[model samples]
Target: MAGIQFTDSAQTYLADLLSKQNTDGIGIRVFITQPGTPYAETCIAYCKPGEEKEDDQKLQLEQILVWLDGISVPFLDDALVDYATDRMGGQLTIKAPNAKVPMVNEDSPLNERINYLLQTEINPGLASHGGDVKLVDVVEGGIAILQFGGGCQGCGMVDVTLKEGIEKTMIARIPEITGVRDVTDHTVKENAYY
Candidate 1:
């Protein structure tokens, strides 16, 4: 599913933008932030030489090179990048129909399905408290080890959030998950929500 369409006009415009940067091997990196959530945003950033992540997929367009963010690939499915000229100069637009849509199924790997629920269902609720969770690993016995970040890492209510919110949501959606465990060191309180 590596089919991200970049319109000819967008290629031209992006190529021109890169050339003006006066840097060799400069390219554009495309990604969606907060993907699978209503707050998702498609972004294009100038990527200097060696700025791309190891997992980024490179696409050579007619006039430009694009580095697609690995984690954002599924959400970017059917995405369109185009440039349109109005009465004013012109505007570059990115239309990603699937950016806010979660993509996963029972056939998907356990890790993928769990992460999908975390990003789509659980994290959005946590984000309101300036926190989120990451799947550290899926150990034996269908156990999911997670690490909390941001406000959740050291929050006072982390235990409640873990059991009542995250764990409940994960187990309900993916029955194969025998249980969820938190690996976060909650003593740090630096960014705790409460």
Candidate 2:
């Protein structure tokens, strides 16, 4: 409601597009599809008149109605909706730098920050090896207790993967995370990749 900036040209373009559509009373909805993770997305879709919940933040432009989920409004603060033309046909883009970036703040809870980093950055990489990591707990003195699964549970290279890959990344990204301890039972060796 307060953060979205619908420029004149953008309004014109969107109005034109909407006018051409078969939408009776429906409008445009801007939303964050995946709130966190590397695949976090900011998108727009045509919404039926009844599709929008009352709590959804509705931005009533002079030419068109734009609806955003209440939760998405904060992430889209100071966002710009614009149309850009090139050699080919023009494209409408939502320029919201803060939208897709994970909410990893130093003042946030240490466990929350660590979980954000792991889900958004670390786990995606490990997933390539049929593995994943989870935060069991964050203990005193900023030590992180983690558990590994899938291919990482019993791999011989898991130690190297932890020290060189996981620890290094976590420590570098989060200065407060002084140490990471993997509590996975490597002796099981059921699904080790190597």
Candidate 3:
């Protein structure tokens, strides 16, 4: 909240847009989709009264009320919302420096730490093969269960990829994880790389 900034022109433009919506309690909601990954995207959408999530941080601006997505707040640090005009017209621009940067630390939760590593390390390598993995849950005894998607789902080389690549990387980086397990039903090989 402290780091997000809205320029005067941007606020006025947004307020005008909201007013045109004609909804009594319409406002703008700011969120980052696919936060903490290369695909992270900062978005602003019209949010009518009840459209806001219960956990959202309601930030009241001078003439507009903004609901900030709680999960995306960290990634929105130092975010900027501005409006620029040219000969053609004016366009609103959003700049979020940390959107695609994984934020994690030793004190962070186990699942968060695992996901951060997956996003920052594992996913990039998997992207080359059109595949990726997601942390499903941390079961008892520190077993980090995961679900693979895309080309890795039914890839014949998934076993080697798991044991040699993913498992080794996760274990070496996160000591709390006793092991990694795949929960994906790989029987459907529609997108399998191999």
Candidate 4:
């Protein structure tokens, strides 16, 4: 899917904003906190030179540079960025379809449905602290296995995140997903954000 779609007005506004900043090789970075769920919110920031991380992805279009942090890619899939003006003033709007509940057909595969819930509904809550979760496998007996990574790997609240957040969300979004299991080894504190 296209990473992000920007309206013409949004492009112009961003370019103008960047030009005003005069920070060479710097542009806007788009990100989300609590992505793909009801509480998700998108944020934009001016990125100066050397601010971009090694693994960050850049989108250059129409004299603008849009940076996507690696950890936020999944949550931002098919997002729309726009600026609208009314009698009051200009307002920035972001339309993230996948940031909420993704459309699901009844016949969708169990694994696919669970994945959608994770990417669209569950994982966004974890993304705030640089965490993400992925589907490991779907086992027999309608068990949906998962592996928490990034900030979630060695998090102190992982159990709460899984049982209260992941499992409950999966069951609500996909009835076929009877249960969830986290197979990640959280002992390594290497990349734990908490």
Candidate 2: list runs displaced more than 4 Å.
Answer: 1-25, 30-46, 49-66, 73-102
- Candidate 4, residues 75-189: lDDT per residue as tens digits? 6777899999999989889887765554456787776677776776677788898899988898988788889889988888899988888888778877777788889999978
- Residue-level lDDT tens digits of model 2 in 19-76: 8888787689888877554465788888778999677888888888988977777778
**Candidate 1: pairs in clash:** none
lDDT-wise, the better of 2 and 3 is 3
All models, RMSD in angstroms? 8.0, 5.8, 6.5, 10.7
Order the numbered candidates by lDDT, best leading.
Answer: 3, 1, 2, 4
Candidate 3: worst 10 consecutive residues by lDDT? 1-10
In model 4, where is the ten-residue run with the lowest total lDDT?
A: 97-106
For model 3 the TM-score comes to 0.56
Residue range with the least summed lDDT across 10 consecutive positions in model 1: 115-124
**Local accuracy of candidate 1 as per-residue lDDT tens digits, 1-194:** 46689999999999999999999989999999998876999999999989999989999877998999998998898899999999999999999977986788899888888888887778888999999998999999988999999999888898888888888888888998888899999999887897
Model 1 misplaced stretches (Cα beyond 4 Å): 106-194
Alpha-carbon lDDT of model 3: 0.90
Candidate 4 — which pairs collide? 36-99
Clashes of 3: 0
Top-scoring candidate (lDDT) = 3
Output the TM-score of candidate 2: 0.62
